[model samples]
Target chain A: MANDNGDDARILRLSEQDNVVVLIQSVPAGERLRLDGQELVMAAGLDLGHKLALRAVPAGETIVKYGAPIGSATADISFGAHVHTHNMKSEYIANYSEDDPYEAEDGS
Target chain B: MINSYLRQDGRKGIRNVVVVAYLVECGHHVARKIAQPFEDREEHDVHVIGFPGCFPNAYADRMMRALTTHPNVGAALLVSLGCESFDGQGLKAHVQASGRPGELMIIQRDGGTRSTVEAGRAWVEEALTTLQGTPRVDMKPNELVVGTICGGSDATSGLTANPAMGRAFDMLVDLGAACIFEETGELIGCEQYMADRAVTPELGQAIVDSVAKAHRHYHTLGHASISVGNAFGGLTTIEEKSMGAYAKSGSAPISGLLKPGDIPPKGGLYLLDMVPDGDVRFGFPSINDTEEIGELIACGAHVVMFSTGRGSVVGSAISPVIKVCANPETFELLWDDMDIDAGRILQGEASLEEVGKEIRNNVLAVAQGTLTNSEDLGHQEFCMKYKRFEPIGPECLPA
Candidate 1:
């Protein structure tokens, strides 16, 4: 369930294990925050559906969602950093692995 | 109570419909004027279905004949411009032979649009009267042939509703019923895995060949992205997207492969190859959901099981579309639009098998003439753009 603040701001939860939170409504940088009984400071501007990391994460680590690894971090991400294309890549895919199945001549 | 009207072909239908069919694009406007006003009201007697082509097409002929003879259609009103190459008389004869009343109205000869609309209304009213007297019988679950398709797919689709529907498809197939899964374009990466599940070696190779054809076809059209939502859901490549979309078929053996308008011969599990066979005459494979449903129904699917992660609110012209919502949050947001909630599996409130049984039961209920959300809301979306497909080779279906 999402609640609208006095000025019409909303929050969305992507997954249970996600340490981040998504704003359904845009919020200014340095906005006060209260989530899951934690008092966290906003590190940057937040847009609708963008994630804010609740805790620090390392590079090359997998991002869990629905109790499964949806993708892995492309770079070392600090707490409350937005998790998106700039830092994450799908785990079910191979970027440059030699085992790339599509590259096979006969696709054995 | 489960009630059905049995057709002359020995198939049972949940609803008795009176189809006002237009034979050519020229007759569409007058036919629509006659059938348009009857649009959302469920008198269980009035509905319009047609194919728009001025030229003769064998595929269109077969489809019109099959649909007019469909158990759900008790009678049909054929509107023709009188000059088009479509065999209006032959189609009427087929409908009549199926023990259903068929009437043909030539718009050019009937004193133009006004007179034809009046005549068409009278014909439909008479057809409805005849359909009211048709006998209703009990329908069996095992006698059903259901098809499943997923659109607006995202990451959650593979993990949830698709697998749930797969479980239901497996159950139906085991109960001596036939199940069809389609959209070969969305099935690129998992072709080998699916081929390996074929009941026969030839069927396995055929599966591989069909997927390859689909890959080439989509590539030709520059539609390798599969779904618009694939990009939104963070998918970058065709294989990653295909791997997620293929979860809807479950572990069922690949029983056969069929072209767009081809129906399965005997039925265990069949794959409907939706790609064009030749030099891409049709613009896109399917512009939207209704065209796919129309093709599925043409292939003798009694019901269509549609899965969506982003929530789609659509129904077919002839058959019912049972929507299974995949994303848990999307399900919550669009709860009223869904028929089954496969997202409950994510919440630990329901198991995959439990949701599967619910989906199967819903299919049974809808087959018995129960209306789905889209149908209830009057979503009779239909579109049949041009496409060329060579008939399936014998190797695609093995006896």
Candidate 2:
């Protein structure tokens, strides 16, 4: 279980191998966070439940979470950057789009 | 000790319900009207479940048969539209063979909706009276089969509700109960890890092959199972969603693999392979949550534990559903529909073990005759559609 701090902790790291930590609460841009005894400032406003990079990840590298690969980075990402669709893509399937060829008539 | 209705097949039921099923969409309205009177009556537990497809599908027939003879159902009233392709007679025969009262009402021959509804109601009333004298038997935890499915999932799901469900499943399996977790499409990336937990190497390979089949089928369809709501909830990729969804299985060893309607032969943890075999004839494995719930009940699940981050309120037609809310915000908005506040783990108020214990207790309470949140609100959502699958090999269910 993740630590239960009253208001001091704002992020949760699921595993030691994970390169990202999930935010428990939203943080405003420019807010300084002292996570794992390391000080870092938010480059942008982070939404609640979103991921923040725990370390620098280069382009084409797999993003690890829960001790497994979730996806690969599309571009070089710095430490503390938000790790989402803009920087990563699925390793198993191609990126999704509305006009893809496999679109069914029922649109399931 | 828990008291349950004893079926002639030697299975025990948590609820003695009279199910009114429609063979096609044409008979759905008549079946609903027949069940309307018993909906408000506490003594009579009548539910409406059906397949709406006009085309004949063997999988649909099998599921209907499984549901009609389900331990929870004491009697069945099947409604048929004379022109539809569904096998109403076969379903009726199968139900009767299970030693339960079965009746079929044809709307076209019974003089349209009004006359058919009147006749169907009378038959159901008689069935309910016969069901009232069912013998009660002591139920052991080993005789119970439980299933878990996650819906409307968000990031908090992996952190709280899903893992807590995993803990509860582990506890159930430890108590010599049969537990099942399903939806292969949602389990994309974790195939290798799942296979590693199998009791036998052959079963492990079968688990791997099932996920591979799902990958190809979904790839050809040009869409992953990850929905737009999932993306908005901060899930970035299919693998992320898969990992979260896989947590509901907990740390139990995989005892066997089962296709839809295949009852587990023993007390242990099993995986329901929802992905169809052969070509992709069916557009999707499941159209929605209710379809999967229907399949779980077909496999003899007495209770379903549904974990949701976006707050789903659907209860199954035959089996009872216990809702576990993952998101603290969603829990605040839909407290009336939620049974356990697993979001308390996210809010730092409770541990995952505590929530898991709550879920275990709730499962036993529901089996002992407590109406779930959705049941109290009269939410008996059900759906069935056409699909095909090859039979499982001996390796998939090794002795």
Say which candidate scores most in lDDT: 2
Off by over 4 Å in 2: A1-9, A13-21, A29-44, A52-64, A67-108, B225-237
Per-residue C-alpha lDDT of model 2 across residues B77-104, encoded as one tens digit per residue: 9999989998899999999989999998
lDDT of 1 by residue, A1-108 (tens): 212322122443434565544454456777766655455566677554355555677988866532235467788888656677778765543212322234212110
All models, DockQ values? 0.06, 0.24
Instruction: Give the lowest summed-lDDT range of ten residues in model 1 chain B.
Output: B231-240
Model 1, range B37-80, lDDT digits (tens) per residue?
67755753466778887766666787788777765678889999
Q: After aligning candidate 1 to the native by TM-score, how far in Å is the CA of B34 from where it should be?
A: 2.0
TM-score per prediction, in order, is: 0.77, 0.87
- How much DockQ does model 2 earn? 0.24
Model 2 whole-model lDDT (C-alpha atoms)? 0.86
Docking class of 2: acceptable
The TM-score of predicted model 2 comes to 0.87
DockQ, computed on Cα atoms, for candidate 1: 0.06
Q: Grade the docking of candidate 1.
A: incorrect
